[model samples]
Target: MKKILLFALILNSTFFYAQELRLLRGAITENLIVNDTVNETYSLYLPTSFSVDRAWPLAFVMDLEGKGKAAVAMLMNAAEQEGYVLASSNNISDSLSISQNVLIANRMFNSVFNTVPTAKNRTYTIGFGGGAMFASILPTFINEIKGVISIGASIGNLEILNAKQPFQFVGIVNRSDFNFRSMYDTKQVLNKLKFPNQLLVFDADRNLPEIETVSKAFRMLTLTSMAKGYLVQNDSLIRSSYNDFFVDANANVTNQKPLLATYQMSDMEKIFYPLMKLDSLKESQKTLKRSTSFRQANRSQNSYFLKESFTKEDYSYYLEEDIISYNYANLGWWNYQMQELNKLDRSAILFEKQMSSRLRGYINALISDNIDYLAADREPDLEALNLLYMIKTITDPNEYTSYLKVISTSSKMEDYGTALFYLEELLKNGYTDTQTLYSIEHTALFRIMPEFNEVVEKYLKGARYDVIEQ
Candidate 1:
């Protein structure tokens, strides 16, 4: 028994160590005249690899406060895992002064590249909340940036800038965010402009599910073949393609029913709800203006409601744009969520809810066995099981059960671990089918004790037993 316990402890410890992350801290001395004095402060993170000779692509992340270098470390770990380089810095100043922001960004970039010269021209920038505003404006000052990602930040007039230079841009927004309206409007404007940008607008109405969807989308973008274009041209089509890929990937895992339902719900709430409200407000305003008697009877009340709704709707749109800025600002929440979701089984939910078409497709691949669509290292296993659980709750049980069968069959050989894991999960959730439970127990026992015929016979005769050939 002690040996068994020791073995279990060793296995668990090995798993934990396999996922351990290491961080490194250092400072850069750059000549930036602030208050007529050249001062310097240290920035920190875990490099892609401990080796100094290997040059990795960089991601410039701002806004590190009490959060320490965890955000940068998360990105660096992801880069290391995904075979990229990320260079990040802490923009020490506060407030959204563009000049100050640009100066800090330039100094950080130069300082980071000076330490790792091979990172030049392969750098990307991510700005979060207020820092997103910095990312939008910083590009105008620095010519070396290859792409930009912004979250929950205000964009202002940044969309009007020329994107002919082939810089990729990705924006993440939430409808419940304070600046949601502005962000949505910015997305509309950018969509109209047809620049090589991708927008992930989430429904704030549902909290956990929405965040899960967003995180999944982000991961799929990183792990799939579609990421090649995202890394290169930053094309919207490529982004869209990735979205579709995730959707398909999830479909294969959960039988497409749950994803379809969630996609429909998100579209209704995130995309259509505000538009419907705006249309109603517009009609009400027109009617109130045309009818003098009605306007006179309740002028103040009518005007107040109309103006309030209109303003709220407008702000919702604005938030879409600003949200991207916040993402770029390197806010702890955004980075933390990314790190946490990356470790979970339901990470693909984040992608399915946030991305459409190709983006959705990329997420689907993460949970699927279609090796052609997925990278050599990426596979659907524990993550797919989590997605299956989520969909099982949101969709019809019978339909979900049938869907589960299909997924189990498709992934039976390659994903036996996930199947057993999810089967136990289903039992925990009150799915008490005797035959199914017995099958799961039998299969698990067989894999561990192939010579235990007596145990197999006992399972076969048990009230919860089922016989199914793999």
Candidate 2:
């Protein structure tokens, strides 16, 4: 039994050693003087047939800190298993300045390329989060960079990206992220540039495994597609690394690749990839049809009322369909469309009126009795107050009045400035019984009103005699 235990320990150690990453330490200099010592660390994994004489395409992964080496190692092992040499580094500073990050990235690239002479021009960089920012920016300096795969980074400057650079860029972002709007804006800019790029916006609430699997498959597809273009198709040996590199690298990889290909992805890719392509195609077709129809309708219509009504109806249907199909919770796009339609003509008030009920319903659902959930939703304070008032009038007036009184008292205790905002909302929404208003005024005097007594006194003077008596 002791011998078996000893053997088991030995076996575990052997397995660990076999998979252990190799780290190389170096330093980078921002200036010619080499004044600041940035500790540069990287890990390398070579394929089974790795040769000093033969050059291999490389992937340089930048990570946030120590984890960069491990992530790179995993990717490297996976790539190497597929007959590719991959290297990774974690030499970035937490400061996140573009200059500092770019310098560190250049230094890491130089260090790795210097050690492995064949890696000079065959490098692709990939990063997650801050690391993604590094990868996105590194190509500007490193002319040899072939491609980039960024996860959760802002690619804000589209003009800087050379459209003809042949650097296939891909980004993975969470749809529910606060940065998603920025991401979409970035994508719009990139799309205008006509650069070879792809953006995979995943559902933010999904697990990391779902994200990682999609990312891994995307990386493989991108690599394989490039490989196919280069006519290198013997990927049998590469299949072995798929499990080591991508298995549990995320979740549900099985059906994802096939789904991506159904929409023009000829290799292992994400299902969303094809869906986006199809969506884009449909949008383009709809836009053309709408423009043509609008022109034709405008030419035939004698009255402004008919033309305006027709346009608003068409836009309303389009936006409603988009919302239902995408399950978009926010009315930002609808608002924007309505605003544009309003600009085109003054008579498009119907769209705005139609959206009021839907918008109010959405706000109420968001603020529904669950305070924790309401807080989690992070509804704007003013909006919350407005909804609370609406809830008071529409659902339970007594409860709403009680809630406002409690809020007013809590605000006095906490010295919250927004109590007045809520109070104003309550007043506007007809929670204006003399007793309730007096209770609010009395609480304010002890805490908040003291700081602004003059304003409160002026407000009280304007109040009705009944309210003042209360």
Candidate 3:
């Protein structure tokens, strides 16, 4: 027993030392030092097979919510399988000013570069939603970055991009994501500039992409590197990738999706033309494109685009008028529209579902934009601000800011009932910042109320305020 115990202890110590030398693979290692001077930290995932002997590819993943570990986890399965290092900063947030966010990203980038033996010409950045926008903007500022994997959002500041500095772009978006149209438009511009880019589409309504989707993106990056002669081409890898994509595209055709099938066929040709022969892909693309289903799909797409243009214009016009007039009555109409859109989401036709999802996403985007505009004015429009926040609670109940605003404004107006109502609603949404709840400007009066204390204590486990007897 003593001998066995000694052997186990030795094995455990060896494993620990191995991981301590460089970040461990397969599990997320949180708060790895990026900059000790700034006390900055980022989560890291080095594939379990990581070694300091050779340089490895790197991906800096960002989540606008600032959950570095969560972001790293999302990419860990993909990164491990694809042999890439993944890092995400704990400090970067969407609410920060552009400069602050840039600084945070720069610090992480420099730290990772200084610590990790990253392959030359293989560094990439990835982000979702606004974070995707942030990642898209990084290649412009940092010439060392070779590509961007932007999810759920399109490029930002296109003036910064030129043929002299083109980079690979891999966009993973969903049918219902608000930025689908923007991503489609950006693809057109990228093609015009002759930049290497690919768009991966999924049929979902969420922001973050699937792990297999991310893995495919990493594979695309690797293939692009090999095509550029930065990495040696492995015939086995080339064959495997082609087969995988071909099988998937053929499956689409089997399911009677000629549009998706044709896109996959065309994308495969673009991706593999430089790496291998494209005779098979060319034939498949030609056949799919000429099919009746393909023609119908094209027509459906064209009609959807036309309808979306008109709907977007109408939404913009109504939003402007509604905000200016502080039209609370329009809430019912918006609710009706949401239901109609939901019906379309359940439609049997894929195109109509895509259209309705786009419209709903557009409305939410418009609301967020208007809120920003209203909040940024020198003389803020309180009525408009209040109206928008309320709408936000309906649109995105998990976003706590709108509830906070409502509670603050209601308290200021001495409407204790309304204030208490929103406060409870905020708590129910999982808000636990007792200090922030008590410290919101114009909320001092309501903070001392017994009703407020009860609600706070119910959710937060401890009430900071004393309840005075009436």
| Best candidate, lDDT | 3
- Backbone clash pairs for candidate 3 read none
Candidate 3, residues 1-470, lDDT tens digits: the string is 11111111122222133234334546777887764489778888878777656789999997778899998887788888999999999998878877788888888988777666789999999988888888888887788899999988889778789788888999988867768888989989999999888998777556667888889989999998999998899999999999998998898888877766775676677789999999878887888888888898889888988988898897788778888888978877666766777799789988898888788778777888888887889988877888888777766678898899988877777877877887888888899898898899898878887888989988997898776666
Where model 1 places Cα greater than 4 Å from the true spot, the runs are 1-37, 47-50, 64-84, 117-121, 154-156, 203-244, 248-470
- Which stretches of model 2 miss by more than 4 angstroms? 1-39, 47-53, 65-67, 70-84, 117-121, 154-156, 164-166, 174-185, 201-470
Clashes of each: 78, 2, 0
How many clashing residue pairs, candidate 2? 2
Q: In candidate 2, what are the lDDT values of residues 1-470, reduced to their tens digit?
A: 11111111122222111223222212111111111266466566555555445456667777757355566654543464445455665556554677876776677666556444343345777777667766776777778786677766666355577666646567665533434435556756766675556665443333122434444534554444445354244455345333334333223224232212221221123322321233543443344335544344334422433444465455446534533453233335544643553354343432233233223333333335333333455443434333333333333333565346544544645644545544554445544354555555336553334333332344444342322222
Worst 10 residues of 2 by lDDT: 1-10
- Candidate 3 C-alpha error for residue 87, in Å: 1.5
What do the candidate models score in CA lDDT, each in turn? Answer: 0.43, 0.47, 0.82
Encode model 1's per-residue lDDT on 392-438: one tens digit a residue. 32222333363345235424445555454444444444454455443
In lDDT terms, how accurate is model 3? 0.82
Per-model TM-score on C-alpha atoms: 0.41, 0.42, 0.84
Q: Rank by TM-score, descending? A: 3, 2, 1
Give the lowest summed-lDDT range of ten residues in model 3. 1-10
Candidate with best TM-score: 3
